[model samples]
Target chain A: MALVEIKNVRKSFGALEVLKDVSLTVEEGEIVTIIGRSGSGKSTLLRCINGLEDIQDGEIRVEGQQVHGQMKKLRELRQKVGIVFQAFNLFPHLTVERNITLAPIRTGRVSKADARALAEKVLAQVGLSEKIDAYPEQLSGGQQQRVAIARCLAMSPDLMLFDEVTSALDPELVGEVLKVMEDMASRGMTMILVTHEMAFARDVATKIVFMHQGRVWEEGPPSELFSSPKTPELKSFIGSNH
Target chain B: MQNLNFQQVLRYQDEFLHGIVNTLEMTAIAAFFGLLIGVVGAVLVGSGPKPVRILVKAYIELIRNTPPLIQLFVIFFIFPSAGIRLAPFPAACVALSIYFGAYAIEIIRSGLASIPKSQVEAGECLGLTRFEVFRYVVLAPALRNIYPSITSQLILLLLGTSVASQIAAEELFHTATFVESRTFRSFEVYALISAIYVALVVASRVIFAIVGAVAFRWPVRR
Candidate 1:
């Protein structure tokens, strides 16, 4: 079975249906890149996987635990899932190291010293070891985003979700963040990212899911989808990017 | 200004000093507990069960709607009718704490609301429990945003402590009244009291500012 499973999920905001009949699966060690235009529900789908957003119909499961309703069940599932947002969302009051270590420590699964060690390791992974003591405000947008990723990584999550993580960075800073993500993929982390960087998707994704009109319209190996253009929407999306 | 004899005022310094102490004590107690109420109300009422949330909302509205002086009167004078007698000082603190907390609840709760929902999402994604999210992620940034507002309300809370003197709590303002009756120098006494009040207000701001620096640990601007 796949690590994550969503079966015929539906979500709506008042009268507006945001996600309709959305179903997908993610296997272990697969780097799946979800690509789409703005408001294509790419970000919403990623949030659903982490139980950040509710699904009105069908079910979402991570490691076979239901991801809908019930707060305790959601928190239990949340431990295995790490999500990085475009906003960075670093706790403004905490130092960078504390931001990274806090969840790990609160879980009581790791000691304070161990959490510190884990923070150092992840910070180094993102090439941000020097910023251990600095607060989020002190860093550039890219740097702060990197700290956010390290904060997620410190939890040792089984699956990681990225919601348009590089969309908020300046063009000059986008490469560094994409590079870190590419490195994570190479290290065999199971990552599903909703991103706009088609080039990066092509380079790093094991599979690319093209979403159009609230559904996974086209999905395949990066080479196949990027080259063959399975649907008119994918073709135009790919065409527009170049 | 003819009766503004500096010598007479100096003679009543001991009484004035004692009143100043009472005012400071009651105000400090009120401010401290008011802040506590604000924090607890903000966190609990935001995430609480429906009935609990409604109860909190009612309290917030009730205190906010009524004048604080009447609230103080109720505690000091009215409650005794039902046999729940409170000393004047404690009664004053209780009234001001509830009254100040009403405005504080609104301020801090809005500050909590202003925290980007994504930050709370990040906490949950990282698997911190709800309480952990409130304590670490939600509260500090929320309070940091409203620190200035809190200082302003605190100075007001201190001035309101003078109202406690009507119940014979003998706070700074009350002591001024005592000295005024003795010297018949009403303007002189009040002017001196105002200076002292200003000094106290300035000191409170500095203290809370230092606290903001330490607790927020973020730069002045978010």
Candidate 2:
């Protein structure tokens, strides 16, 4: 069975529809990068996978359990599937160490005594071990983003979703965040990212999906999709990004 | 401006000291209880059931729209007619606390609203429960965001304690009234009490500043 399955999901916001019949499947240890213009429903699809947004129709299952419905069920699904947002929404009142350990300790995944070691391990994974005591505001944008990833890593999720995690970073800072993600991908972590970094997508993505007009316009290996453009939308998108 | 004679006013130093102690005691109690109500009311307004939300909303509206003096009157005078009699001091405390509560609720509610939705969503993404999200992620920052406004409201509550004088509560203003009538040195008496009020406001500001510094020691985002 696939690690994540999104089937015919339809989501609407009042009069406007954001995602229409979006279906995709992600196997374990696969790094899938989704690229599209803004308002193409790419981000919405990522959010729905972890039950962040309620779907109007269809189903999303992570590890064979349904993603939406009861709060208890969504909480269970969220534990297995972690999402990092565009805004590194770290708790401003807490130190980086406390921010990382809060979820693990609260969910009973780790005891208070072991929380310090758990935080250190994840912070090290993001190459930010020295910033364990620093607050979110004390770090640079890239550092904060790395801390956000570390916070998610602390959960030990089976799948990670990156929703434009680097979009809010400075151009100079973007590479550090991408490097951290590349390291995670090399470790065989299953990650699905919504990003506009065409070069990084081509190099790091095991599979690249092109979404246009609320649908998957094209999807294939990075070589095939980038080398030979099938749809005009994908071709134009690639041309514009390059 | 005429003949300022503070010497006569100073003769009643004991009475003035008693009044100062009483006012501070009442203000402390009212402010503490009022803050408690404000936090609980803010939460209920944000996420409580429909009936509860409406009930809290109605309470906030009712107390906000009415005058604190009249509320005190109701508690001190009207309650006695209805078989609920409270002494002057206790009646003043009850009325002042409730009065402060009404404004505190709105102030705190605004603070809660000021927190970005992304902050709460981030907590939810971590599999924290709804209450946990509010407690761990939302509450402190929200309070921090509105720290100034709430503290100012607390100062206003302290000033509002003067209204309890109308009920013969023997707080600062009530003592001023007594001394003024006896000494007939209204100018000196009013002048001295005005300085004392200013001193009290300054003292509260220093206290709040210290509290704010301690509670929110984390660096703020630029």
Candidate 3:
């Protein structure tokens, strides 16, 4: 079984359906990039997997544990599925180290000392060790996103969800965030990304899923999907990007 | 013109001291109950189901629209027929609490509403339970954002205690009334008590400022 399985999921906001019969599987240590135009439900799908948005129908299982409807179990699943949002969402009141260590201390019941050590280790991994005491507002957009990544990594989640993580950054800052994500990819971390960075998606994605009009329009290895998309929607989407 | 007895008025200073103590005690009780009702009502109105929220809204509107003096009279006079008999001090506290609570609820509810949804979602995604999120994320930030409003409401409640005099609660204003009547020194007695009330308001503000700096240190500078 895959590490993360989203089976036959359907979601709607009032009358408009955002995801229709969406099914996908994320294998361990694989990098899956979901690409589409705006309002294509890529972010919504990521939110459902992370239990941020509840699906109207079907199940999302993180490591075989159902995430929807079971509120108590959802917290446990969320601890194992770290999600980085487009907006960094760092706790502005806390320092970067405290932001990273808060979940481990509160949820995992790790001692403050141990949590700080783990936070430092992950900060170092993201090349943000020098910013342990800085507030989120003090950091650059790229630095803030890197700190957000470290925050998720400190929880030691089995799967990481990146929802347009770099889309909010400055044009010059995008490459630094992409570098950090690529480093995580090289280290064999299973990641699901909803992104518009075509080159990074082409280079780092093990699989690329193209979504259009609230459904999976096409999906395959990045080479096949990028080079010779089967569906007209996928072709046009790739065409618009280039 | 020399018929006025300033010595007797000076000798009854103990009664004035006792009145000050009584006023402080009443204000403390009223403030406590008012804060409780404010926070609970804010939560109910802010997050309750639609029907419950409507009920809370109606309750707040009813209290806010009616005068505190009239509400005090109703609680003291009318509630006795309903088998709810409270002594003057307790009745005053109850009435003032309900009166001030209405305004505080609106202030706190606005604070709760002003909190960005993203912060709550971030807390939820961090694996914090809903209750934990309310405690650590929601309430802290909500209270921080509304500190000025909360303090202002508290100070207003403290001033509102003057209305309890009508119920014969024997707080500061009631003391002034009694002392002025007994000594026939209306102007001096009232002026002294006004100064005391002003001092009390200033003192409470200083204390709250200190508490705000300590409790909400994350947001407020030292």
Q: After TM-score superposition, what is the CA distance of residue A95 in candidate 3 from its true location, in Å?
A: 2.6
lDDT, residue B71, candidate 2: 97
The lDDT ranking, best first, is 2, 1, 3
Ranking by TM-score: 1, 2, 3
Q: Give the candidates in order of DockQ, highest first.
A: 2, 1, 3
What interface RMSD does candidate 3 have?
A: 2.8
How many residue-pair clashes does candidate 1 contain? 0
Per-residue CA lDDT of candidate 3, range B1-222, in tens? 456555666666888888888888887887778778888898898778999899989989899888899999999999999999999999998998888788888988888897788888887888988777777767876888899988888888888888999999978888888988898887678778888899999999999999988876553223
lDDT tens digits, residue span A124-150, model 1: 999999999998888999999999899
The alpha-carbon RMSD values of the candidates against the true structure, listed in the order shown, are 1.9, 2.1, 2.6
Best by DockQ: 2
Query: What TM-score fits each model?
Result: 0.94, 0.94, 0.93
Cα lDDT tens digits for candidate 2, B127-215: 99998998999999989988999899888887888999999998999999999999999989989999999999999999999999999
lDDT of 2: 0.92
The DockQ score of candidate 3 comes to 0.48
Q: What docking tier does model 2 reach?
A: medium
Better of 2 and 3 by DockQ: 2
lDDT of 2 at A45: 94
